[model samples]
Target chain A: MNRPKKIKPWWGILPVAIFLAFWEAAARLNLMPGHLFLPPFSVVMQESYHLIASGVLIENFLSSLARVVIGFCSGAIAGLIIGGLMGWKEVLNKAFSPMISLLYPIPALGWLPLLMLWIGINEALPIAIIFICCFFPICYNTAAGIKSVDRNLIQAARTLGAADFRIMITIVLPLALPAVFTGLRLEAGMAWKVVIAAEMVAIPTGIGALLMRAESLIRVDIILVCLMVLSFMCFFFERFFLYLEDKLTGQWNQHAGY
Target chain B: MPAIELRNIRNYACHGVNLEVFSGELMVLLGPNGAGKTTLLNIIAGLAGYDGSVLFDGAPVDGVSPQKRRVGYLFQDLALFPHFAVASNIAYSLKANRWSGEKIEARVGELLDLMRINHLVSRYPHQLSGGERQRVALARALSLSPAILLLDEPLSSLDLHTSKYLRIELKQLQQRLDITTLHVTHDLGEAEEMADRIAIIHEGRIEQVGRPQEVFFYPANEKVAAFIGAPNILQCDKTRALGHGLVEVTCGGLPIVVPYDGDSIRKIALFPRDIYVSLHKPPGPKVNRFKGVISRIKDLSESIRLVVHAGNNQLLAEMPRHTFESMGLVAGQEIFLILKLAKIKVCEGGLCEQGDSK
Candidate 1:
């Protein structure tokens, strides 16, 4: 049952509201010439409405969302398969762990220049960038999850007449789910950042592309609108992933006990 | 014929194990920690590799896969599948053996009723209490009606009352099912309570195997005597052979006779229950009589344990609380003792390390 009396989050919202109000006031009063750089809240809202009405904002948002979603999914699938194998089999681990560790530290966006050169500013560029960013965490977490399955459970399953493959499917995979989810969440965040970076570098239609174009045109309001839209998208996805994690882990924890 | 047999099963630094358990008997593999009892069970379950052969009903199963080995293992932790509900966990082994859906359902239903866990069919392991989890695990292991049941300290983790109750339940169930069961535990009390035959394992070797009363009274070696709960072991420095499986020995300057084939036994063990304590002397001073002062008294709830000091030797004597109260026993009081010479266990000749005392 849900608790009836809840602590209002108005206190948490106060600081952000105050900051935005201060910005709006400064822009409206034109405190200084540089006030142009900080547009009023009304101006930002008008710019957002115009973009939405013209369909630019929705199209660009959809474009960025698609890239991130597709890239993240492909990368996560690959990571789970590869990492599960690496953790399950010693030979695969010995072969791939070193390479993963070596490559993990390098930011996925760092490959943008080389990728752009090879793939030439197409949709592939951002997708590849996002995929690169998502892969490492997903792989690492999944491997750690698989490795974390208790040895006793496996032995028990074997004695219960489960073959090696059945043991892996029934015991190993389920036990590793928590860790796999952890990897997916981390990769999703990284994927969003990579998509933005790649789009800013060279995308025909995306929020990141709009932000760059607005930067060139010196349209501070449109830039701020684009920034806010991107942030809202990221926040929404983060909450969605968190809810998914909570539901799955909550079910798992009930089964696993303490 | 034996239900399960381990012949020269040596692996993982365990000593050579040659043991057998007959059909329809609850065999308790008793030992202290690091005794390789679990390893022996693992070897029989085909979970651990061993050099020698394991036979079930006189058939060699050395090459059988663990999946094909019809031995149900109940681990110390139970190892129930946490993600599955009680019914599914029980049905898991059956499904693995390729049982059809309807058969699995029927089998799970049967096990649920048998284990009295039908009410918990849909409950996850975490949702159940310790005893419930234990029963569910047993149901899962028994789903396949295994050739032999291997219980690896299944009752060790429960509370005292639960362990005691479960011990009786396990015994009755084993009898009803007539399943050859090999239960491993370091708890001597449990072994005494449940084992139809007690296999005394030590350092990976089965030192002795016999009925509960036999192993308790007539341990074949010093290791078995020490491991069993013999509170009084006397040093026999000089021994002379007597006729026909008897030995006369001088223990702590007192001569006593013991039943044995040789004169090489350097020590003899006496249970506290075998010794009688009295305020006045009424018998002859022979192999069974001694004079000692009560050094310490331990209240054991149901019974009292009294340690007697006799000529640089500490002898333990146990009696009912009613007897202790009736005799007005107290520490530092001098008393006469009788050890019942016929009950003296002439331990097999070897250096036997004493297991944990009490």
Candidate 2:
């Protein structure tokens, strides 16, 4: 297991640096006709600094983060339980597979009107939407992971006098961890996207609300700041899940070429 | 150690199979591909369902769950846990059986030392070599101190040199442990080298069970004979009855004498090892003797294989490497050969005959 050489972190940000430089140059030279909507990179940076000084950016960012964390955790836990059961038991899989297939294709926002009538447009609304968005991919990926486990490992465990529950805990779950992590990482990105959309429609306290407020004021600089923060948050979540996955199932990933 | 007995075992992949493995003996189940060798082992370990009764030391274990059967099984793939290190893999059975932490650790240590893999305790399955992985799997299987051990083509995955080395090591370990064992393999040479008693299985049925020599030299029927590597199988061209319960069959212009039964023999299988070759004609009984020219020679490390063109038939003969070197044999040279008359197998009907002379 010879590991690949370490890559410098600054190399990854080079493209962003080049893009910002081009955008600033284009704006200063009046290269675009719709320059009002496309603010200069320096202007967006100035607006970000002003929002942070006034405490509005930190407050709104924390609100979105809290909703995502809570919604993602709850949805991920439920998905793990249901998906594990469905994968392990044929009867459960047969019973739930049709329903999952039908519901999985429905976008998270499609349930917004129905959910608003039931739970109302409150903080709970955005959290619920994020939950719906996170559940499907996590659930489906978890089940696929469990189903992909080698039957030989289970049989070997049985021959060693391991009971069904013991086998599930010691063999099945550990083997499926890599897949579970993949599901979690996918759902983490989706959680951020869904939460932002839900906040724009149903709440007024998150970064999505801040973006909507900026749009009404015709402040392109503020809108650009929100978009940059959201992009950074998504990247952060992806790296966080990747680090967790590597910590838990690094040996398996290396051995299996995952 | 307990003797394992399978009485009237019937499954999707097994017919009415009745086999008895003596206590503390390594019994090999020898057969060709898709011969239900693995199915039989699964039945014994209680991993597969069957209608017949499985008994350990005369006590029925037909209703026992696989977890409660107390059988050690080394699968053909080795099935070592990829995630767990060598020590953890061996300790898995102990942990599953609910041993205390101290006991588990001690047992794992003993197994690691016994398998001579103490240096690989922290290494994962993928980190170890093929032979090292095999040793770890063996140690894991033995951690529970099972009543009987079942090995399903355990050495089939390794290269020739490694497989040969591990075969002798496995046999020696099995002997030292004095545990009842059932080893399944498709290799006739492996069966002959390691088995105390060899059972020939074909098409989900036990064809014959006997000592290695008995099953290899005197296969009960055509299927067993063909599966046991009789390289000199010749189709008979004609047959004539000789007096005193003897019949002569002409095959490819060569006349072969076999003990007469009323049934007609269509083909005869002669083991390569049964054909004796010499440079000079010896003064002895002249039965089944012919002079042939060596058409080809194959060096097999331990033995030399010679293709002899006798009469109109090309016959294969094997001799010890030292004997072959001492005789200075070479291709295109004329030699005298003798086929042991009593060892020739007479096959009736067809190659795919379904008779079981158990």
Candidate 3:
């Protein structure tokens, strides 16, 4: 019975259209001052088609996406388990909170050189880096989400004959879902960023490597093409997460801020 | 229906509290704030650690966990699951107890109909009005058909009209269900309204447990007398026997005749609503009548409260707004006040022992 609201699609794309038109005009007029480095929008589009036809773009895009998915899923699952335990049991929280606090402040990329030495510059290296990036935010947010559950709700559950495990599953977890989704959305974006950086430094495949290759050859259009692909992928993941969050926890969104 | 008995129950907030709530009775635990009324309820529900035994229908449930004890608790905040719709909230216990899907659905539908919230089954807690939310909470508490119901100030947060309405509804529901209930509230009006038997608790101990009229008119001690809104407590200066089950006591330069008891009287307690005020003195026995001038007037919405200065005493008297208007009363006006002789509660040695006065 519910219908989606109508939206004017052009309103979303107007800014991109204006920027593209300006770039094409600048390049057509031969506007100097690093004009060679700044490729025209049309040139980037043409290069994109070439890369796609040759299967290079698809190959790198899939490889990067695979690493992000594997890393993000593994990190998110581990975060959920550890965070749930910590949040539920005070002893576990006390034992692990200090260590988590100590390590969380270090940037994900800060672990790269050591991870490259340990993981040896392969697919595992980028995946591990992305995993590190995804872990902390998800873990911290999950623990906080569980901790913030109303005590009265737990008491109400107890008086209703709900066992401890049932209370956790039915009351605590569902109440914490909105915060968990917040953590997931945050780490999803971080996973993409970390995977690209890791692929550039420690792996030979993916969009990041394609950018590195274009940089060495001074092929600015190829660099522009890689940037566009990364931008689209980031946008796609963000929208996907937002859609998932809304679908799963839309009823609680108004109260999630509490 | 199970009779709940707490024997010498000791906890962090409450100590050495002994009380019994009879089967199928709504016993209101009336107290001021920090009086451990909620702690006693928690002890009965097995949610709090206590030093003494809690018995249900004369069987000890000391070691029972809260979930297995079958106590339905309606928290002061109601604590309806914000994430669940009304149907889900009511079905929570049934689902927890592993009731079949069909049974859960049937019971939820039955409760929705009972609480008169069938149309709200699909709505979330935040989407409902205050009264609707309260009904949902009550329905959820009664979902498992719990043996004993513990309500902690359930109607304290409601508007006056809604609170009054729900008090009647709750009392009727409790009677129809025939469930033993321990209802805690700091509001005297609520306790008087909903209680079958009222237990006045102060400083973690039960001062008195009796019928509502007995506890109101004949408080067991000074603390219960003070907490139950006896606004005219005066220190007795002297007392003399009047020879026919009556004694004359001078309190703050005002001589009042009260029921005679053997123990020495030190103070006298009078409820504001029991005092009669009039513009002109009518034909009466004049046992405890005195001429007084109204010092201050307060409008209490339904009634008018006057501070009457009689001799060296300041007494609070309340009457219906219509009565006050008909008398054409104002501040500084002289009036004759009659303190009902039998209703004047006399305290002996700072404590009013039970059955000391009629």
Candidate 4:
């Protein structure tokens, strides 16, 4: 007889419920200052209900989302073109590889001092940080993906009489699109994390800025509400991105052969 | 006019590979592994660099690119693009050649019908069977209707039954289209079955080029003889020239006569089935009779292969299983074999000089 799994798939929800219960207990029992420092789960929930009712949540939500979307698009587009050129052309690779390697290792937040100096206390600063955060993964993955395209496909296309340029765009690019999308998803996650940090540090209107303001005001329930809302937003976006990817890949599978 | 005339084409894999393929005929480049058969095809297709000129329809094509040379090439590995549907795979070349969408659609449909996989139009290459893949590759090559078609072992990747079926179909298709084709294959059977002319390549060189029957019945050299699956290539010890185009030679210390030419009659190949085998030595005078023993017998699907051990030589012979069974031929049984003076081929240069064959 087969032994049943010690933790069933449904058991995955248990940890989150248990953690919220523990927090509620700790706050209600006065292990910490419930009103000023640490709020019970119920208190955070009540505060979140009010925040959503008043439309503050949606406003802060859109503010953060707009920054991430604009920054990510700019960064991903730039990365794709640069990475594609570097991967396909030797001269471009030699020219840009050295510079990219030098800059890629620095964390997205580490550029905060530089961005603040150059762009100086505006929405563009946080957007630039998100862009930098998203850029490297997309760029690196795209380049590697392009480089790893099956040489046989390229050769077959050429012999099939596809000109040099058409072969790259039609065959090589589509073949590497999956890897590029993988990079996009990875960078998206990074973009969310970095943009939040940027908003907390510099921006005044996003969810991260709300969390910073709550910290100074000692509104512990508001801080917990901000964390909960941001998690939900990021989770929703990830799921939405995945759904879009499945649709795109499903269409692609109709023609895929190799 | 010849479809392809390779004049003294020399490269590392090919050495002075001169060949003339007549229009509307299949010329097979037959060789063993690394014999440069594919390289020769590549050179003619303008996919490889070579020194000597390749003339297509009496006009030199060396300066042209592979695309401009207008030769359809079926790669040995098939090289089917994975991201295209079966119909689109065939249409790719037409699209590349700048045929209008309407023309491409018509050509693709025609090729799909000709290759007989119209049902598989929407199917991807990964979803195809081996035979389906072969047909798709051939269809993809023939879509644009180039002047010359080059096949590099088109059927090597299929099973025996599939290979046999496709071989006949490809030959028929080639005949119908009347497109000049150069086919490369390591299998002599494929060459024999499909080629109008066979060019036996060896060591990066053209050893012999002749009609299929000529190459089979009368291989130009010992290497050609061995390579053609003669199974009875013998080294001659002594040779005596007689006038009127005849020569007497000793094969494995047994006297044999051959209608020969040239100074040195060093070796010869005799087709095994052509030699008559019997248990009893005949009373009449035999011209080329040799005493040997059946060392081994293999029961094949339809034939029984017998390995006979004559003096200083081993000969392989095959006969119908029923006949072999009726004759009660057994291994280790002493036998007498007869070689007709007419059914022998004189290998101009002995295989001993070739040295590669063990």
Candidate 5:
């Protein structure tokens, strides 16, 4: 008797429920040892609560979060400046864009050994690695943003008597903000990923370190806890990014969304 | 004193073009597509690079940049900043000129009032309709108080109805502002409506410049005559002078007396409206009448345009719609043309022979 919408909200929740139920049934039925496989969603939820209550878990979580934020912020700032310069001047774009591409393809984790050799086992190693990982996306996006501004807007500014720097400040920056935000979204996620990798080897302090420790002790439950924490961080940041993106790009969508 | 003088100005697209625009005059630059009308405007505004000098109030302007030249330009597309509100767009010029905050606000407010868009000041450029956006663009240009305003086909993109309305507003605003202007358009109607003087540019060269009446009445050559709406250009061999601004020419093996005051090989131009049509050849010595068979009869409001094949020449005449109806005029119908000599302009050579070719 009810008119069903094309896409029902509750329909999306079905797949997650099925996945958890399958895992729980398999573990409880002893398809695999409960200790080795960690018995599914209920067990993981219980472990999450226990981990949160422990001060060590809270400390590691905060440390990882802090690393991501600091690295992403620094990297994004550098990206903005470099990208703006590259976009504005053809000479600069030629000079620096190739250098960026050269460094971009090398994996972020590839520098972990070099960073450790330089900064040693400290937070700097992880933060620096995260910063490096976030840099390329942010920088390239910013440059593209500036270049992509409608040429008519620039012409209008010139006719209004705007000088060079003023044009860049008032017209170019605002127009490029959407692209910068896009870069930020991508870079922020990269920074979080970098933090995990750095924490595992160089610093040994956060979720990645916890996963490594659990693996050495042959405790799959704790390892699953570390992964759950990482997944939660990615999910939380992605949501926050989407919120910001929606606020900025929703109106612009009508004009140039495609 | 001239408000703006372009001396031997040569640039890409447009060659050396010399022009002088007096203060407070609305000068319309008329041209066909790719005649370099826009290039001339851009060179004056410093938007494009060019050779030679553009003097604003007797000072050389080539050394000055676009912002420093103080010339306001409205591109064909009306390049209004899409990101800024209308008020902000107008105020941008003032801000760039380093006016104080209160001064900028007062100037912007006055322009918004002048442009009749005080209600839409907060709205962005994209939000404005075609006509509203045009007014905003004009207001933005005027805010700078430039030496001369360059309007590049300001109404070209609008619908026919919108263009007509904007043309009236633009003409009124130009007079009210008392700013020297260089307006460019390919439309003869627009030139007739807005120009104090018309300059017809063709192929990067100014083909002719004079008062609209002078250009329309006495076009220098065939090209200028055709461009200014001279519908009938009859190729005739002049046989003898009929005396007192009249000449007898053998057109299509038929000798037709035309009003020709000039000497040598003549290309006779006649306005379709000047040529009257009659059902029967009316008897009058005062009127020059010739019988012809109507080949094409186009019904236009107020008047009927008739293309008549008289002997070897195709003669076009216009009469009131009722006259054609009363006469029962149709295609293949025979009619007589009452030719008026005063309305006919005779040019000796072509468009290129005269006007600045070098």
Candidate 6:
């Protein structure tokens, strides 16, 4: 006599629902000031609704997403090119490392003033900052990935009459793809962070600008809503990138040999 | 033109060694570890860079890359591509060779059927067992229909039972494919079972090359004899020379007749299987018999190996286990031994000289 397993929806939603309920109750009971430290959850939701109605929040959200897409794409492309070049040729990697290090830790914000003067404080500045910040880790990891492809795979490919280019395309690239995807995921997250910082510095029509606007009006609820929106967007991209990574690396997981 | 030939083939590991392998012949290279068997195989495959000339059908292949050499190499590790499925892996070389799409598909299918792994076409390397993967690797190497095939310890990774089965499959496949193959293995049984000609390599050179039985019976030197399972190697200083191809050497204070050339060394060698044991202590006529003390007895299923000390020479003799058991063979018991003069081979210089067994 096999019994059906009981399902528990409460356990599934317990942590988030419990925390939100406690927050709403505490704010409504006037345990803390509702304007700043303890803004009512309902008030934050109302501000979110008002912002969406005015279309400002949607524009800013779309603009932020656009920047992330452009910046992440550019970063990934540059990383793949430079990383592959460096990984294949030891001389190139050695020559490029010092230059990469010089610019890596400059933070997207630190470059805002200079980029605004050179490329202007327009959308280019923010996208460029994101590109610069995300490029290093992606390229470095990609080079490492290429270098780490099994030597036996290369030898086997060569002995099987595969020429240099074919071996690289068929054997090297596929084996390096998993490591390359890891770099892309890491760079995607970095793109989100750096793009937000870029928007905060130079862009006036983005989620970061929304944060700035909330601060100016001293609307704590709107500020909290904007921060939460940023987090949600990051979460979405993370999950999307993870799905891509899984698709690429799932083959390696199933095939344990070499 | 020979199917393959290496003339004055001097490399870092093998110096001044020449070899010629015939088409449709299965040549086995036997050597202990560090004897450069794999190095020689790799050189023949053009996988390792060498200064010597390797010719296929009279044309020198020294300048050609291994890929262009039309030589298939099954590495000892059997490096299979993990990302590709079984069929894709086997078809990789065909695709690389620019074969037509239909031809590639047909060839891969035929090879899969030949290797008896058609059902595993879509499965990856990890999904297959060791023996299955080995067959897949072999199929992949053979995909392009190479001119020659080189196998390095093909069955070493397998267990005894699987190795036995694979050895049979490998021999059958080589004949069916009609490709000249150089199979390297340290197992003497594998050589005896598969080789048309056995080349026993020692210290990076071929010591003897002949039929398996010939190499075993007539080793070029004492080292070669011992390595090929020869049990009794004795140092016999020449005592007297009787004309007509015979020399009398006194061993164990007993005179024995040995057939030797005028420049014969004072040493003689005998394999354990060549020596016979007898129960009667009375001397036998027309057969060279010696009194020996059975020092140790070992039961080897169908046969028993006895360690007997005769004439200051410790001789190991393999006899029927039933005969030994019926005789109630025990240590410290005196026994009579008949040395087969036809089986005793004398080295030129001395008994214990070292030489390559090719």
lDDT for each residue of candidate 5 in B1-358, tens digit (9 for 90 to 100) = 7999988888778777889899999999998788999889889888788888999988888988777888888988887766677888888888888999999999988888898899998888778899999999989988978869999999989988999988998899889889999999987768977999999888887878899866776677777865664557666685688798777776666676767665554456666777887787688684467788999987756567888988788877877687778878789877777877666556554522322131
Minimal lDDT window, size 10, model 6 chain A: A249-258
Put down candidate 1 lDDT per residue, B109-187, tens digits, no spaces: 8888888988888888889999999999999888889869999999889988999999999999999999999999987
How far is B250's C-alpha from truth in model 6 (Å)?
A: 24
Indicate the docking level reached by candidate 6: acceptable
Candidate 3 lDDT over residue span B1-358, tens digit each = 2489888999898879988888899999999888998888888888889899899999999999998999889888899998888999999999999999999999998898889999998998889888899999999999988879999999988987999999998999999999999999987768877899999888898899999867886777788876665447777867788878888888888888889765467877777877999778857587788999999999966678899999888889988798999989989999999887777766655344433342
lDDT of 2 by residue, B268-331 (tens): 8777888999888967877688899999998866678899999998999998798999999989
Q: What is the TM-score of chain A, computed separately for every candidate?
A: 0.90, 0.93, 0.93, 0.86, 0.90, 0.89
Computed on C-alphas against the true complex, the DockQ of each candidate is 0.47, 0.55, 0.56, 0.28, 0.34, 0.44
Candidate 3 matches the true fold with a TM-score of 0.82
Q: Could you tell which candidate, 2 or 5, scores higher by DockQ?
A: 2
Superior by lDDT: candidate 1 or candidate 5: 1
lDDT per residue (tens digit) for residues B3-45 in model 6: 9998766677887667888898899999787888888877776
The lDDT of each candidate is 0.84, 0.87, 0.86, 0.83, 0.81, 0.81
TM-score, prediction 4:
0.75
In candidate 6, residue A185 scores what lDDT? 70
Tens-digit lDDT track for model 3 on A1-258?
989988898988999889889999888777847736777888889999999999999999999999999999999999998888888888999999999999999999999999878878787888888788888888888999999999889988998999999999999998888888889887887788888888787789999999999999999999989987887777788777778877766785674332
Candidate 4 vs candidate 5, lDDT winner: 4
TM-score of each: 0.79, 0.82, 0.82, 0.75, 0.77, 0.76
DockQ of 1: 0.47
Docking class of 2: medium
RMSD of 1: 9.2
After superposition, candidate 6 runs with Cα above 4 Å error: A1-13, A32-36, A94-117, A255-258, B8-17, B202-204, B217-229, B232-358
**Pairs clashing in candidate 4?**
A257-B82, A258-B82
Winning model by lDDT: 2
On residues A35-150, what C-alpha lDDT tens digit does candidate 5 reach at each position?
Answer: 56565667877777888887767888888998898888898889889999999998999999889999988888999888888988887888888888888888899999999988
Question: Runs in model 3 with CA error above 4 Å?
Answer: A1-12, A255-258, B231-358
